[model samples]
Target chain A: MGGSTDSGSQNRLGRRLLTERVSGYWLQGAGYFAIVLFALIVLALLYQSLPLLSEYSLVQMLTSSNWDPAQNQFGFLPAIVGTVYVTALTMIMGTPIAILAAIYIAEYAEGRTKTLVSSFIDVLAAIPSVIFGLVALIVVVPFVGDYLAPAVGSSATGLGIFTVSLVMAIVVTPFMISLSVESLEALPDELRESSLGVGATKWETIRIVLLRAAGPGIFSAVLLGFGRVFGATIVPAMLIGGQTHLPSSPFATGQTLPTLIVNDFGELMSLPLTQSALIFVGLMLIVVVWLFNFSAMILRQRLQQRWQF
Target chain B: MDRYTEQRLFGLLARGAAALVVAVMVLVISVTIYRGGRVFLMDPTIVITPPGSRYMLEGDGGFLHAVLGSIFIVGPATIISAVLAVSTAIYLQSDYSSERFSDTVNMFLNVLWGTPPIVYGVFVLTVIIAIGARTSMFFGIVAIAIFQYPIMTRYTDEALRSAPDSVKEATYGLGATRFETALMTARAALPGVIAGIVMGFARGIGDAATVLFTAGRSTNMPAGPFDGATTLPVLIFDQAMSFNAEVRSHAYAASFILIIAVLGLILVSKLLAGRYARYAPGGRHS
Candidate 1:
């Protein structure tokens, strides 16, 4: 058997060597192609955006709050303010609900309830933002205007920072909940069981046991949700009436960075600097999200090192 | 407190809180229904119904052009992105070495992955429009494809890495070339690749920012890749913002379609991911 296998192995080795050479060549080629393609996209975008430096001073663009295109003066300061406010409000409103929902799903819910809830969250994750905005415009706006707006000291129109933020919160909640759920589920069952053995209630076990174990992961999810809300355009565009200035209050009118870019990019066609200024805002958003992702990666690595089943 | 009483309190609180989440789903459906369910049920004028005597379509309630534009943008982007991603993944998962190179590549991919679609849109549009890439559906397609490719590549790379080396060894022993082994032995991994692509496509289709700048608003039917087009998401944005009641109703109808389409893509991808995981080695959970 050993003698026969030697001959067979020799023939197989020959073919394997040939395949190895071909695969190695092709694989590297493919990887390089992807890299080049990605580089091209970045280069293209940067090339177009770089032209803005010739016309506008960075300070005037960033510091000036006025965005009146008719006067040819463009400032993104108010848009930035509105963007941060709405995103901050979304995080504040959505984070707790998401954490609680995640706790319920990971620790307490069982049987069909778990399946149903998980699938529901999955479906929610899939819904388009345009749809979210449309529904919010017709239904949420009217309801808020009729019921909550008066109480919140706003007019009966559905347009306001609070409305946009609320919709954004809803849009991002599923992402937070899903990530938190998965991280919580990844924790050791023994941890929960041991905590329970110590006579802790389920709620206490969740607070002390699950939260501690999944804290980093939950935080990462919230950061991701922040990015999602920050980049979202349609939700603020339609729901908040796409005001280019900062809202007077949380319940007042507002616009976000992406919405403003979308709303005004067309009008600033002749002013390449204004458009590039918008691109710079987008770049800042990318930078913020990149930082979040970097930290999320670091947190994930730490969690992997610290946790085990 | 007794065990039974304690269990009851926790369960009650859990159920009560969970009910609120259920309320959100209900709110989504009910609000959609309240706004446009009547039109769908009563008039049943989906956008694609044949045209009438005039140039006006018979059941022109939905933004059919936008829907078509979405499909148009998503379809090619999905194909190209999937191919790029899977190919890159295969390359990364190969016996290639050097830990530093791997880490560098991962850092680039992750940062690119985290970059939002809107930012990509703004950046890409500025680049393309400045270079005089005509404002058309093609630019939207390309912009979305560029944005989606990195994500697909990462997920596909992970899936390929998870593919059992033993299987590849077995294929190699059978005298299969690397490409053959990748194509044949790694064929089992295609489902996850498809899932990643579909997930990306779902995101691309729903995206509003990238297209808003690149794909200018055009109410007319798209002539070709270069033809200016308004996607469903953009049209929904337009109609939602419009003062016209008829257009607003049309926007609701379009939103209903987009919602259903996105949900369908997600569900199908989930199903595919499950099926892929079953036969796959180590079972990719992503």
Candidate 2:
């Protein structure tokens, strides 16, 4: 009887252990569910967008500049060009200033000053994109309309690609500063000391040795900033003035892919083909932004590996 | 060139660039304050009244409904996201997962994080339509939650991974189940988890793109998750785009309030992270 009772208790314990292991498996499965959801989102977008291929040839849809939804002719060239132009302009305007600020914070500023500057960048990062749009609408637009546009021999409505790009530059500067600061800070102090010991000036050391070592990280930061600028909808949508045609100048109004979706999505739903075309825009955004993000991640991973070795 | 000249020139350029950034930030804040401050100077009633109130030519309207709507949408969404994110973090950091799997998960999360919020809005809009549901706070909450999920999960995973392995081993040696071990690990990483949740909440509240199409705009305060609601960001967007000068000024006022709330949240998260740093093993070196 004693042996039988002992065996019964052992069986119960075994069942309990088995139940516990099963619960653990369930938990891990739940974790993987996020990945499943992401894949589903991608698939849904692709499925919705595939119909556009039948309506318009891929080359015609992508290359043609005319986009008249009322006439059933849909083209994405204008928005595509606007997106590329605005993102490029933002990088050109923002990157150098951000790098300089980051260098000052990472290499030059001491205790209190460093903390203050870093906090400023953090605060900038935390500000809402809508707020940036609103402020730009009030301040930057009027300035461009009144002063800069006229100076450049363009009519000054102040709602144009250039105005949008300027706001975008400001919006993305904080991200660049923070990322570049991390890359700069991650460099070894030994390198700086050796450079100085070898009779190199501080500026020369930073320009040559420190920057070269941190190049991959800094490049990744710029790529991340590009991704951010590309994905941004609210700021550009609010400021870009919703023009569908190709811009004649930086001072001319334009639309980006995200802005196109945001501005016309409500009306586009009534037209099935136009809705599908909008889905294609969303798909394009996903593709471009994902590439930038993936490349940045890879570069950062490689940098980490280098440091580990 | 002489070393002194080169150093001086570089220093000058750096300072000038840094100052420019500072100037830009200052300019933005000052412009908003100057313009938004007008609402207070003219009629404080406009700033205090609930949405759907009568609009006078002199800017007599309030955004209380938008403020409340934002809270209603973000509060439950943040809670839902936090629960999912913490669960995912706990499971992924457990011994059942492999390094390769973790890396893959991280890569997926990075991609998700980089996705435009507008795309999320579009995706949710399609889902809502297919299900025959109207645009409402429920849809908005779901959309924002989706956007916050990867962010919260990534941060929480970092925190959980920082938990010392010895503590985990001790729990396992005591005959604790994997679930119990995860619970213990979560307790140790509570501060970081809280910080992550707060960060996600801030991002969700500040975001306009994700909710733009999912949540139909309503003038009245949100009745429930099913009711159409308008948020502060959406309100700002609508008002800023209006042709009327008074409405534009009102948008600036709304922007100021939103800015204050978001900045406060960021500050709190920073303080919380700092407070919990000592408990994290990685915190010691940093």
Using TM-score as the measure, the top candidate is 2
How many clashes does the backbone of model 1 have? 0
Q: Considering only chain B, report the TM-score of model 2.
A: 0.87
Would you estimate the TM-scores of all the predictions? 0.87, 0.91
Off by over 4 Å in 1: A1-26, A29-57, A295-309, B1-14, B33-37, B41-46, B49-62, B161-165, B173-175, B270-286
CA shift of B187, model 1, Å: 2.9
lDDT of 1 by residue, B71-171 (tens): 88878888877777777777665456366656666777766766777877776676666577768888888778877888788867766666667778887
Worst 10 residues of 1 chain A by lDDT: A33-42
CAPRI grade of model 1 = acceptable
Per residue, candidate 2 scores C-alpha lDDT tens digits across B1-286 of 7888999999889888888998999888777777777665676676568755543233445777788889888888998888888878887874768888877887788788788898998888878766889999999899999999988998899878877887698889998877777887876786778778887888899899989888887777678879899888988888887767877778877887787788789878878777876665455422
Task: For candidate 2, list the clashing residue pairs, or say none.
Answer: none
CAPRI tier of model 2: medium
Q: Estimate, for each residue in A1-309, the C-alpha lDDT of model 1 and write its tens digit.
A: 698899999888888788778767766776776556547656655565566656678778778888886675768788888988998888998888888888888877889989989888867876778787877776778878788988867675768888888888889888788989988998878998899999987777876677877887887788778878888877887877767775777777877887777777766577756666677667667767767787888877787567533
The number of the candidate with the highest lDDT is 2
